[model samples]
Target: MYVAVKGGEKAIANAHALLAQRGRGDAGSERIGYAQVRDQMGVLVARVMAEGSLYDPDLAAKALLQSQGDVLEAVTLMRSYRTTLPRFGVTEALDTAGLASERRVSATFKDIPGGQQLGATFDYTHRLLADELTTPELPTDPLTPPSGDDAMPRVTDLLGVDALIEPDRPDDWTDPDPADLTREPTVFPMSRAERLQALSRGDEGFLLALGYSTQRGYGNNHPFAGEVRVGEVEVEFEAPELGMAIPIGRIELTECQMVNQFVGSADQAPQFTRGYGLVFGRSERKAMSMSLVDRALRAEEFSERRVSPAQDEEFVIAHADNVQAAGFVEHLKLPHYVDFQGELVLIRQLHREFEERVAAARAEGDARAERRTKKEDSHA
Candidate 1:
C-alpha cells in the first residue's frame, strides 16, 4: 500500500526537534558551549572564519555548535549572518609589514633577522594524544605559544644577498581602486583583488586539490612557500576629514608568500617572482593553498606556459566556492516540473511523427501485396 506523505509542516517541525536532540546528544552529558567549541575546536573555527570572511571567533563557535560540527555548514551560517549585517565603514588597508607576528617562517633563507617562531602549530606533534586530554579538568597549555613580537623583518629582506632582486615599484604603476565583490558583479578578466576575494571564500578541498595538481607536474612553475606568517595587523584607512591615515582596528591575519623561479628572458634575468596571499584569521592552510593557486593563475605573468586546471582562473575561481556551487547543484532538486513537462511534450511529438512515417510505409506495402495477389488470382 502506498502511504501518502502528508506531513510537510509536521515533518519540518519534527526534523527540527530531532536536530535539537542530536545537537544536545545524550541527556545528562555536558552540553557543547560556544566558548568550549571556539577554544577546543579552534582549527574548525578558523576554517569557518576564513571562508565566511568574518573574524568573530565566538559567533563562528556558535555556528559550529549549531551545525553539529559540520565546518562548511558553520561557515555558511556565519556568511548568512555576515550578509545581514550593515556595513558601518571600511577598515584601512592593513600594512602587513607592520604586523605583530606570532609565527613567521621563510623557506628562502636558513636564518633571517626576526628568527623563526613556530608558534601554535601541529607540525612537529605526534598524532597520538596524552592521557590528560581524555580526563581534563582544566585547560592545558599548547605545546608552542606565540612569542609576542611587534617588529619583524621580512624574509625578502634577506634576498639582498644578491643584487638581482630589487624592491622597486615599476614607474607609471597605477594601483587602481579595488572592486567591491559584495556590492558589485564580478566581470571577466578579474583583477588580483577580485580573484583573491573570490578565493578567500572558496572551498578548501577544491582549492587544495587544484593546488596539488599543479605541484604534481601539471603546471611547471617551480613554486615554494617563500614565507608564511600568522599574526595581527592594524587596519588603516585614509580619512579626508583628518587629512591623514588613521588606524581603525586590529584584525588577525595569515599571509603566505610563494616565490616561483622564472628563467631569464632576453629582456630580464632569471629571477624569483612572488605570489601573495592574505586571509582573515589564522588560516595557514587556506592562505597557503591560495598562494599556490594565485601563482598558478599568474602563469602568463611569470612567463611560464599554463597547462593545469589551477592555471585556468575562470574555471578555478568560478567553481571553487561551495556556497555558489552547492546552491546551483542542489537547486536541481527543487520543483522544475514545468520544464520537465515541456521536455516530455517535445519527445512525445517526435515519437508521434516517427510512428506516422512507419505506419504509412506499412500501408503502402499492404496495398502492393493485395494488387499482386489479385493479379495472381486472375492468371490462375
Candidate 2:
C-alpha cells in the first residue's frame, strides 16, 4: 500500500485551470498589453531575454504575461520556445567599437573622447518615491554634434599606447571558433569563449552575488570600471549563397571593461589587466557584475590564487542557469508520496529498534541491581 502511488487527473486539471484564471488577473483590472510590457517593463524584458538566451523582446513580453511575472517561469517558456525555432547560420562578430553610444562613462578618467554622456540613468536621483504615479516627459539636452575625431576610443587603447596593459590579442594569439554550447555537451576545461557565452546567459542575481564576493576579498580581484558604454550594435548574418553579410536589425548592448592591477610575474612585466563583459540591452549593472566575475574566473590565466567560488569556473558556470536551479528546487512541491512513504517506514522501524534496545538495557540494569541487592542481603 505504501509503495503504490496515484496522481489526481481531475484535481490537477482544476488546479491548472485556477492557475490560468489567476494569471489573467482580476476581470475588472485593465489588461496589460504587449506594448506596455515591452516598453514600460523594458528592463525586465531585457533580463528575461538575456537569461532565456533568446533576444526576442515581443516573445519575452508574452512569456512574462503568461507566467504572470514569474521570471524563472518566463525564462523557461522562452527557452522552450527557442527549441522550436529554426536556427540559421551564426552571425558575424559584433563591432562594439562602432556602437552608436547612448550612455558612456569611465571611472579611470573623467576626460575622454565623446565625453561622459549620462543617458537615461537613475544615478543622481534621490532614493524617495513621488506622491503620485505619473509619467514625466523625457528631457533631451542640446549637445554639439560629433566631428571626424569625435569617435570615442576604448580606454584599453589608451593604456595600450603606453604599454601599460597587456594586449587583448597578443602576437601569437589565435582566434578559434567557439564551441556551440547549445548543441555540444559542455566539456570540462571550457575555453574563455565558452565561459563568456555561459556568463552572458547566467542569472543576474547569481553573478552579482559572486562578483560582490570577489570585492569582499574572496578572490584576488580589485577592479576598476575602466569603461562602461551602453549603446546599439547592429547584428549581421552572412548568407552563404548571397556571399554577403545582411543586416538583421540592431540590438541594445551594455559593454563593460574592467581594469585590475597585476603584479609582475616571471614571464611578464607589471601592468594592468582587463576583463570584458557584453550583454543584450542596456543593463549596465549586470554587465559590470559580469565583468568582475569574468576577471575572478580568470585566476588561472592570470596565475592568481583561486580561493573563492567566484574564481571556480565549474562552480560558477554549473550553477549560473537559474532555470535549471529552479527546476531542481521547485520540484519539491510535487507529490513524492511513494518516496516519502519509504522514508517514513524506515524511520519508524529505526525508532522501534531504538526503543526496544533501550527497554532491554533498562531491564538488564534493573536485574543486575536486584541481583547485587540480594547478594548483599544474603551476605548480611
Best by lDDT: 2
Report the Cα lDDT for residue 361, model 1.
96
TM-score of each: 0.81, 0.92
Q: Model 2, residue 8: displacement in angstroms?
A: 3.2
Name the lDDT value of residue 62 in candidate 1: 92
Estimate candidate 1's alpha-carbon lDDT, on a 0 to 1 scale.
0.78
Write the residue-wise lDDT of candidate 2 on 42-125 in tens digits: 889989998898998999999999999999999999999998999777899998877777888899998987778787787988
> Global lDDT of each model?
0.78, 0.87
Question: Compared with the true structure, what per-residue lDDT tens digits does model 1 show for residues 1-380?
Answer: 11224676677678789999988899999886899977887777878888887888999999888999887788889889998988756666577876767788887777666667787788887989677767335348544433344346666555635744434245677767766676888787887778988888788888788778878888765777778989888877777788788877787889998877777677777777666788877788878888888878877765667777898888987898787877788788666777999999999999999999999999999999999999999999
**RMSD values, in order shown:** 5.5, 2.9
